[model samples]
Target: MSSIRLIVSDLDGTLLSEDNRLNDSVIDAVRRFRASGGLFTIATGRFGPSARPIVDRLDIDIPYILCNGCVIADRDKIWEMAQLTLEEIAPFLREADQAGVTVLLFGEDGIRTLRSTPETAYFEQREGLPCVPLNPGDEAWTERPVQKVVLIGDMSQIRPLWDRCRSGYAREYAAVQSEDHFFEIIPARQSKGEALKKLMAHLGVAPSEVMSIGNQLNDLEMIEEAGIGVAVANSHDELIRHASYVCRNGYGEGVVEAMERFAAIGAGSKGGNTYVD
Candidate 1:
């Protein structure tokens, strides 16, 4: 697949509609893209279980980037993982709890939390994974390391903590705000760009042969790294400034527009629906 075009897209606010569902057009577009010998996969902040359903729905054959790139997996197995120890997370749990932010822990064991909050409830509903109650003092996290630690809740509750984590934990962690209220904490070395490079090395593809789309801070590095970086109409201002092209549409429509742009570019045409940054 070294000679094939590799396309990696973000899920929420890029591939999914504003309503958080994949539209029929995207499904067909992905199928057509793969049918045309393109490698299609999604790089998302979601864990495998959360991202797997869509991967299965699209019947994607390529390995997908997950957990904000902390994990890489395909339908049958996990290809790579970067983990954090409970000792590393203990400081976070204490600080976030004291700061009144809700923390969601991701591990090989699934999502574990101190208690179910409205934010966690929304997460449960979205990810289709229940929060296994494991308080700060619980023994469950003591022996095992986690893949990622995410903070989700109101902005007022998460922002100051985000700032603190950025300043105080910069050396030990990579803190990214995936959404306004969703702050993800991973090992300092992990990111979608690095993971994409790893995948490329594994498959013998180069950065110049890959195309990626995203709309948030977490997607920034990969957007800057890919040969063709795309930002949707509703993407963060910062991302738009760095993107190689901006899609005329938003969400799933933007996804369709991007693949169309890819098709156009493949056919030796640069259409007006996408603009150079």
Candidate 2:
């Protein structure tokens, strides 16, 4: 029998379809898994503004790793969270601005941007929330520190800064790219891997009993940390190369193939709607 009890997956390029909607096929797959006494949830870089609606729509009853695992939450309770203080990222903000990177700040409450930009609007539309403009000098949210920060801009502009920040800021954050256009900064002390470990302990499961799948650089640690790690076909080369298994399919279809391969999750596990090459 498969030791897998919990299955956590990332959103965006892994679980959601190319159109960015959660489709029936993936929903059906998850429902079947749940009905079979399996636990399923999401581990996404997104927070309440974005991740929660999907969780509700899918009726996911399990805790989700959010903000790159800076917080692990369910509807009523936030089981875990890590705050990034102004002192911690103050230096990076200056460097990012100097490097021509636009910033987006995330907190438990909402998202804020240094100023409105096409990037901010795009992210806002995707998240189904307004990206509020930031006025750091204002005293309104001084005590409300952020949990994660996104630095984004042109690939040429941000990549070199990312390379520098990756090493120079290593001690303060776990910097990784969620997409080619964006770099996410999560506190070094926090990660989806650590959150999964905590959840496993709480459920009385071992490292050998969990499975995880994701596509972005943020997903790297969690994928490496899982007992059975899977990657979508569309994942970055770094993750795809490191994954225990790479799905022939991508997105929601990839998720289905992965569950079938690792846990034989559904009765007709060998069959699904065709979306693979």
Candidate 3:
């Protein structure tokens, strides 16, 4: 049997194809892996409502990471959550809004925006969730706990905010670039890696028994935390640098390649460090 007891992967730009759909090979491989007594799940920046369909499609029963690790839950219940206060986020919101950047707030209630923009509409359509308008002065919205804050804009507009957040709030919050136009903020010390650690403990699995695959900077920590870290062919340069193995294939193909190389079903021994073509 493979030493890898669990496999966690990122969604966009990693497991999902460019068209934002799962490839058949990926589905088949995951089903086979699970059937062989291996556990599988995803760690993504998407929320429960948006990520639920993917989980259902894969038929994963384990708790998965969400909101870039601010929340962990399964279809039936939330196992863990980390939140940020309005005070912690208010300044960044003001700066982003003043700069004409679109901000999306995530909470238990749902996604909300201070003001609607083309980006807001796109986000709504893509996530299949409405971005309800919440005035800056609204006290009711503040009553809800926020799991994450996302700022969407061109790189020119986002870079400054990302830099400022990193310099100013590094001690209190984690600022990561989920995409070229997407800057995300979650509580400091909370990340896909931290959440994965929690899940490992819950399942009584050691770090040496885990393998993680991802393509973005937000996935860095989880990749580093796993026993085998894989970077897809389309991964960010920095993430590739940290990965133990870099795949020649991208998207679901890369996922399948990694599984075949590292977690092959019924393999008597663990796989080696060779890259897949």
lDDT of 2 by residue, 127-209 (tens): 77888986857745434678888888776776676666557543566766887677787777788788888877777777777
Best by lDDT: 3
Candidate 3 clash pair list: none
Predicted model with the maximum TM-score: 3
Q: Model 1, 11: alpha-carbon shift in Å?
A: 0.6
Worst 10 residues of 2 by lDDT: 268-277
CA RMSD for every model?
5.5, 3.9, 5.5
As a whole number from 0 to 100, the lDDT of residue 183 in candidate 3 is: 84
What TM-score does model 3 achieve against the real structure? 0.90
TM-score of 1: 0.88
Per-residue lDDT, model 2, residue 138, is 70
Q: List, residue by residue over 89-201, the lDDT tens digit for candidate 3.
A: 57768787888999888888799898999999988766778999887787666556799988898877877766766566535777787876888888888889999999999
